[model samples]
Target: MTQENFNEGLLGFLDASPTPFHATQNMAGMFENAGFIKLYEEQRWELEPGKKYYLTRNDSSIIAFTYSGEKNYVMVGAHTDSPNLKVKPNPVIKEHGAVKFGVEPYGGLLLNTWFDRDFSLAGRVSYLDSNNIIKDALIDVKKPIAIIPSLAIHLDDKANQERSINAQSDILPILSTSDDFHFEQFLKDQLKISGVDEVKELYANDLNFYDVQNASFVGLNDDFIASARIDNLISCYVGILSICSIDESKPMLFIANDHEEVGSSSTSGAGGSFLENTLHRVFDDYEEFVQMIRSSIMISADNAHAIHPNYPSKHDANHAPHINKGSVIKINASQRYASNSKTVSRFMNIASSIGEPFQTFVTRSDMGCGSTIGPITATRLGIETLDIGVPTFAMHSIRELCGSKDAYSLYKIILSFNDS
Candidate 1:
């Protein structure tokens, strides 16, 4: 696909996926539309060569693969989850003539960016049906329903210099001014609007508030794209497009797991047995599974921090990645990123063969480094892996930015990698 078309599709995916559940559902739909058969974990598997299959765990993590009877496979890994504010179980709070919702920060997000923005709720909700059967449904309150307004500067004249956010008291999102507001009734209303009409008890929900603004092109020449959850969702989008557009006859797989933002320890996360268990199921022979893993390579795609012109000192001058330069190869001496000499050479060769420029990132020696699912997956599966990403700015902010050309560039490299 053309770069323009690819970016348009990416924008759509970003706007549609406000939570991990929604991202997984949207990606599963893409695979299904490309003739991939959906598999359930509870079902017995009947292996068939030259067919494609996709499966989900916890409705928030997804894995899609093509079976070609090959011992080795090409793999891509990404995370569907991003940093946001999660709603608590007993979220309702009435104070000072306004009804607000208690929220907890989901990850290491920029708390300041979340203030004074229009917000909406989206996630998975479980409830009993009319027949008393438990069922889960996805919900997206598309419109702006809440906001966390910053305290006026007049009240705290030192706000610009001395301001600090108290996560408990400073970030409660105002839902409504009316004291009669009922959180459960409001959720039921949203469920009905989302087509879940069976009137029954609400068992539970895993909801997160997201920026209501849609993804859009920015910059004087529209060279940049801006949106919430761009840190890893952009990588997920690139992986989806790359895997779907490649030759499916090859033994290739693309997996987008949930809970990566929170250390990836959940059952459906990279630290869990989801990917390993799935591989074992696909290759029943233990020896063959080992062989496959040993011979295969995985590219873990996550967003890397680009050198900010205003804060250039934050990055190492020699290892700073620039916007639109290319996909970044993230490296860390502490193994925070999984990139190694062998994997780096393999990735660089693919990009070079495709005539695409690539960059490398290394944090300053005095600074600590953040991580992705790369090292975790590599350690878990004992697979050769590399960490790479599109150079990004304002990562983990409510609205992040990235060059419009970077995602398509990574997509091209991944296509070449799959063929190699």
Candidate 2:
């Protein structure tokens, strides 16, 4: 796909997916459209060579793969979850004449950017049906419903110089001013509007408030794309598109795991048994599974920190990556990232073969480095792994920025890697 089309698809994916559930749902749709047979973990599978299959866990994480007779596979990994504020179980709070939502921060987020933005809610909801059966449905309150208004600077003159955010009290989003607002009724109305009928009772919901602004191209020349959840979702989109566009007979797999931002310890996370269990299920024999894993490699695609012009000192001068340069290879001597000389050389060779420019990133010596699912996946499965991503700015913020050309560049390199 052309860079324009690739970025267009990325924008659509970002805007449609406000939460992990929605992201997984959209990815599943893409897989289905590409003729991938959906598999349920509970069902028996008949293995067929050169067939495409996919499955999901907890409706939040997804794994799609092409089944081939070859033992070795090319794999791409990304996370579906991003940092945001999630609604509490009992979210409704009426105080001082306005009803607000009780929200808690999820993952490491730029808390200040969340204030004074148009906000909406989207997530998975579970409820009892009219037939007395429990079912789950996804909901997206597309319009603006709530906002976290910042306190006026005039009221607190010190706000600009010194201000602290209290997660509990400072970030609650005002929903409505009327005392008649009921959270349960509001959910029921949304479900009905979403065409989910026969809702008997709302048992539970996992909802998050998101910025209502749509993802779009920024700058006069459209050199950048601005969107929420771009940190990892862009990688997820690249993986899915690359997998779908490749020759189906090629042995490849793509996984978008959930809960990476908050440490991937859950059942659907990279730290868990999801990928390993799936591989075992596919290979069946212990010997073949080990052989396949040993022969294969995984590319962990997460956003890399781009050097900010305002604070270039934050990055290592020699290893700093700039936006629009190309894809970045992230390395850490302490193994915070999984990239080693072997994997790094392999990736560099692939990019060079395709005539693609690439950059490297290493955190400053005085700064502590952050990590991705690369090390976790490498340790879990004993597979050769490398960490790479598009250089990004404002990572973990409500809205992040990345070069319009970077995503497509990485996508090309990933396709070439799989082909190699």
Candidate 3:
């Protein structure tokens, strides 16, 4: 596909998704549109050589695998969750005649970046109905939903670059006027549940503040994409596309896990039983299961840190990745990433066979680096894996930057591996 089509698809995913549930739903829709079948973990299965199967857990993680007896297994992994704010159970509070909701940071977030930005709330809400049965549902304000306005510029003139944001007090977003101080009642009404007193549980909620602005292609030549969740969503999207585009002559899988940022510890997280359970279900016996996992190679697809124009000194001088150059293979000597020699060579060979341009990323010797789902997944499943990503900047910020030409190239490389 051309860049235009890719951008349209990317932006559409970013816009429709505000929470993990929404992200998975959007992906499931895309898979369905491609005519892939959906499967639940508890469902009984019959072997169908070339049939496609997709599954999800708690709407937080998803895996789409295509099975056909083959020489080897090829898979790609990415995370669906991103860093944002979560509303607390006692989110309702009134101070100085103004009403605000209390929020806590969900993952590693750049607190200052959230200030003065228009935001929204979107996530799963569980409550009891009239029959007293617990029912879960998704709620989205679907507009410029929430805002964390900054203190007046004059109040802290150095705010542009100097002020520190207190996550508890500084980040509480305004909901309404003084008359709106009845936040508990408002929340109960908004969620369509009983009053705080009648309810067995009252959670202000774990809500994130989204940009509410849809992603778009913007550049003098339209060679740029500005959006949220590019850190892993890009990988998730491309992985699914690559798996769907290729013939399932081999066992091809796309595993998108959750909680990568806070460390994948949940049951469906990369650090948990999702991959293991799925693998066991795929094989008939123990020995074959071990063999299958050994023969498989997972390409951990997440965004790599790109060189910043303004701060060129932060990166390793000898190894810097640029936008549109192709995929960046990240190697950490500390084993924080799973890129060993064998896995690295295999990835390079795949990229070379397809003539896809690729690069290497090594953190500067003195600077600390971040981790991805690669090491955690490799360790948990006892499979060889490599770390790779499209180079990007402003990685954990409210908005992120990436190369326009990179997605298509990465897609090509992933397709080559699956086809091979």
Superposed on all Cα atoms, model 2 deviates from the true structure by an RMSD in Å of: 0.8
Residues 172-272, candidate 1, lDDT per residue (tens digit)?
A: 99989889988889889989998988867998999999999999999999989999999899999988887788776788899999999899999999999
- Enumerate residue pairs that collide in model 1: none
Between candidates 2 and 3, the one scoring higher on lDDT is 2
lDDT of 3 by residue, 1-420 (tens): 776787688888888888888888888888897777888888886758888888889887898888786527888999998888878876777777677888888788788778777887777767665668676666677767567777898888887887887787888887666554564455565566322234445443545667777777767877678887887788888987888787756678898998898999998789889988887887868988888889989999999988888999999977899987888999999988899999889778988997889999999989898899999988888888999999998888888888888888889888877655
Local error of candidate 3 at 55, Å? Answer: 1.2
C-alpha-based local distance difference test score of model 2 = 0.94
- Judging by lDDT, tell me the better candidate of 1 and 3: 1
Better of 2 and 3 by TM-score: 2
Q: What TM-score would each prediction reach against the true structure? A: 0.99, 0.99, 0.93
Cα RMSD for candidates in order: 0.8, 0.8, 2.9
Worst 10 residues of 3 by lDDT: 193-202
Show model 3 residue runs off by greater than 4 Å.
158-161, 181-206
State the lDDT at 56 in candidate 3: 89
After TM-score superposition, what is the CA distance of residue 314 in candidate 1 from its true location, in Å? 0.7
- Assess each prediction's global lDDT (C-alpha) against the native: 0.93, 0.94, 0.81
